[model samples]
Target: MDERLTIASAKANLEKGSLSAEALVGSCLETIKQGDKDVHAFLELSQTAIEEARAIDARRNAGEQLGPLAGIPVAMKDNMLVQGWESTAGALILEGHKGSYNATVTQRLKDAGAILIGRTNMDDAAMGSSTETSHWGPTKNPWDMTKVPGGSSGGSAAAVAAGFVPVSLGSDTGGSIRQPASLCGVVGLKPTYGRVSRYGLIALASSLDQIGPFAHTVEDAALMLQVIEGKDPRDATSVDLTQTTIPELIEKDVRGLKLGLPKEYFLEGMDPAVKKTVLEAVDRLVAAGAQIEEISLPHAEYALAAYYIIQPAEASSNLGRFDGLRYGYHSSGQNLKETYERTRGEGFGREVKRRIMLGSYTLSAGYYDAYYRKALKVRSLIKKDFDDALKIVDAIVTPTSPSVAWGLGEKFNDPLTMYLSDIYTITANLATIPAMSIPCGFVNDLPVGLQIMGKAFDEYTLFRIGATYQSLTDWYLRSPDTFST
Candidate 1:
């Protein structure tokens, strides 16, 4: 064993009686203890992994019905509430906060017999592109310690990359999950909006917020998705979808698959290296029997502006609960007005405060139509682009991010630049489509992700295509020996 096996390989070993879930969990714990100092991926680790392993073993011994992920240990982003564990959302205000109740996804994972590995770091309240905004500190990329892992779910992706955990859950609001997974060289999926319950996730942009999975292989991500996705009464936005079985999806070949290339995504000033990776991926798909064609999404140019407006507006309302009256920390104040001001001002980081102010202003009486309403209209158009394109193409392909993972502090100060990091991803969230980031190539020794956008509720197609590519290429199997201790 190479010490890092894909879900398929691990499960095979367990089924064949060559290894046990307990042994795998123990190895993972050892890896975390030895490597987390450099990766900075995990905020906490489950010391009781052995106990969970024992349960897994007992179930197997009993020949009882086993969930697909019976013993897989998975990391979870800190924003989602997991009972008895601290759910920080990587913000200073919620530093000591504990999850009073299990989020729907957490409950589902437990029900599926998956072990909760630990919580991972993220941008403060899931605000920035780089994990540097985290109160705990930035999650360094497992490929390069001096560079970022990519944010708000950067820690979760890095945890999987560093072998701290086999798979992890991340929330996306304007590319939080996909971008980080791209930069960290892991398989990350941002499912169509409403595919997964957002009940316990700390909201950043409610309309755009989505929970997703990150793993080293496409099948592992699919496995994780199976356990967490579905409709839930707790989240009114959650929608029921017909999921394609992973085993069947994985076996499906790419022959005759039509892949659409969005012209707007290949704009001027795009990094040469990033463009190269995307083009090479296109060629790879072509070789795999996919018919590639360039398609124009007319209103695609305005996706970022539209996304920024809608996201912040949703963010403002969603963050209103943190007024310090009910839960979490509160600062000193003599009156209610001062209390709200003090709590928010002191709680949110600079990037988060900026968005909140922008959101509040946009939704205010006079500016509502000019900003918020206009953005909503453009959002409709952008969504139509995907809907129309999917009519002809099975899936769309693009660069997951504008560039490879930059230095930790590179774009931290410039919010617009940081927001642009999600250029290729936000539109997927806006359109409520399934999108994924898989390792395509490297830019200057750093990984780049080839993003595949699927039709609404068609995550299976994305997985099928991604698995085909991963099967043909050695990218996913490559490790960062320089960073993963």
Candidate 2:
């Protein structure tokens, strides 16, 4: 079996009897066993995976109708709740916490016959841009062990990149999914704010967090999204998309589509090689008949500042429930107030604490109007910029990140540099729009992602453009040399 088998190829082989669910699962488990020591992608392997595979194999032999992702091994980010599985969200505060209920997304995947392979690592409470902040230690990029696989969804991206799983679910809040996908050389999607349910996902920023998929190809990403995308009563924010189904996006016509190139994204600080490769990709789209026009997103410069304030504010409020009472870590103190203080102080990592404090201060009485309120107003302006631009163009394009994956420890001591990593990706979350990252090219053997943004609920267009662009190039086909056994 090919190590880098995609969801589409795996499904075809499984349906045709050329591949058995058990065999596919075994192969993936073997890949994890062989490579996860270096990548540290998985937090814990699911014991039910083999049992589920055996049942699926039995059903196939008995001629039972299977679901869309039948027998496919899929990884879930630690932030999402999987019943009976420990979900730490890469934070020690929730260490040994077992989920009693499945997140809506987890149930949807299971209903589709996807085998839950394991939970992948993430930044503590999804606060950091690099996986290095994870309490379990960083998830190394498969392409280069010393480099980080972007985060807080880094483990999921690295898992897919390392052939541990063909598809995985990750939550994106301020570029968590897309940034890591770019760094790891995979296809990652952050759906429109209400497109997918957020019921089981641990909240980072309630308004910004969205659960999405990571896959090796655009079609696989589309397929994964198709199964998980629909209204759920459990999530108040989920929209009713029952009447609308995304069309088969593979090789869709993109000839006459207008793609806007955001001038703000291609600024002075980006890696020269990354800028050249992204421009070259745009040229390929132009040669393929898509029209490209330089567009101005005037408020994009303030996106990062607004995002940091809003995200941390929301995170501070949401993470308040884990203060050593009901579940998670506990630190004893003489009084209730002291116990609360001690537990939170000892349980949270440095980045998590920093954000919590920042959020607390911003939301406090004296600073609320000056910081939090101002950020919200700026967020609206940032969103207006995209809304105005999308009216004229079918989609927006840019480099997913300023540079490729850097050495793991390089930016850990410099929090400001780490925050800048989400500079190109945060606007989409603020605007509540759908965005995707696909491999555009490589710089020094590391992958660079081409980010595509679409109007609200217009993921179909992003898929069409991504698939068309992928068809014209083979960058997504390239895998890490060390993990390509």
Candidate 3:
């Protein structure tokens, strides 16, 4: 069996009678058995994965029409609320915490007959970029074990890249999905905010957080997005979206498309090799008939500063629910205040606490306008910039990061450096525009992600452009370096 089979290919194989869902699920399990230890991608393995595949086979034998994603084994990030499974969000505070119900996305996937493979590890409370902050353990890069798998969605990306699973759910609040996807050599989508339901995702930063898919191909990401998207009464912020259909983008042509390069993204401080690979990707996309245009997103320069302020402010408020009264870990204390502090301080990872403190400080009476409120105004300007650009271009493309995957323990101490990792990505969340990351090329044998940003609710353009790029190259098919080892 080809270990790197994509979701569409797997479905086709299942339909052609050349492969069985059971066989496919077993292959994924075998990959886990072979590689999960060295990679540390999964927190648990579902005994039900094989059984779920068997059920799909049973349905097929019964002549029932299965959904597009039927029989696929998908890994869920630990942060999503899956019934009968814990949604830890990689924090000891909520460790072993199972939701009373399945999150809307989980229920939707279950409806489409996707098997729940297991929960993958992430940074505690989704606060850090590297998976080293995971309460359980660090998720090493599949490309090079010594280097980091860019995270808080590190495990999700690693699993897909290593072929443990073809698709997984990852929540991106400031590039958790795309950054890790770039590091692990897979495709990650951060659909426009509210494109997918946040009803069951453990909130990191409510406004910034979005749960999307990680896959080996752009088509697969679109497929997963199609499955999980739509409005729900459960999440008031959920957008009223039309049902989407993932088309034949892989073999389709996208001639005369406009690809915008934000001047802010191409400026200095970028690694020469990453810049080179991304520029080459631009050439390839252009060769396929895309018109490259240089655009200015002046407010883009302030995205990081604005994001840090807004996200943590929302996070501090969202995290307020964790104050020893409800949910997971509660500490022994003589008074409520002690319980609150001790439970939070002890339960949360260091990075989470730091953010909380920063958030609290920013939102305090005297500092609110200077930090939180001011950041909101700048965020609006950034969103306006994207809107203006989208009017002139079909899609905007940029380097997913300033450089390729950094070595493990390299940015752990320097919080500012780690924060800047999402420079290219944070603006999309702020703008509430759909953006996606695909493996554009490699830098030093470590993959680099090429980002495509689209207009609000315009997921089609992003997919069309990304799918166009994928058709031009086979970077998406490259297996992780650890796969060989």
Best by lDDT: 2
Off by over 4 Å in 2: 1-3, 247-251
Better of 1 and 2 by TM-score: 2
Worst 10 residues of 2 by lDDT: 242-251
Model 2 per-residue lDDT at 455: 93
Global lDDT of each candidate: 0.87, 0.92, 0.89
- lDDT for each residue of candidate 2 in 1-485, tens digit (9 for 90 to 100): 23467988888899999999999999899889989999999999998898999999999899999888999999999999999999999999999999989999999899999999999999988989889888988899999999999999999999999888999999999899999999999999999999999998999999999999999888899889988998999989999974344546355568999999989888778999999999999999988899998899999889989998999999999989988988889999999999999999999999999989999999999999999999999998999999999999999999999999999899998888999999999999999999999999999999999999999998888998998888888888887888776
Tens-digit per-residue lDDT, 1-485, candidate 3: 23476898899888887888899899889889889999999998887889889999999989999987889899999999888887789999997588789999999999999998899999998988889899999999988999889989999988988888889999999999999999888999999888889998999999889999999988889889889998979999998877464555434566888889988888888898999899999898888888989999999889999999999999999998897667899897889899998999899988999999999999999999999999999999998999999889889999998888899999999999999888998999999888889999898899999988988888888888888788778888878655842
List ranges where model 1 is wrong by over 4 Å.
Answer: 1-3, 483-485
Candidate 1 local lDDT, 38-156, one digit each (tens): 88898998777789988998899889888877787888899999888988799877867888999999999989888888899999999988899998888899988999999889999
* Weakest ten-residue segment in model 3 by summed lDDT: 243-252
Residue range with the least summed lDDT across 10 consecutive positions in model 1: 243-252
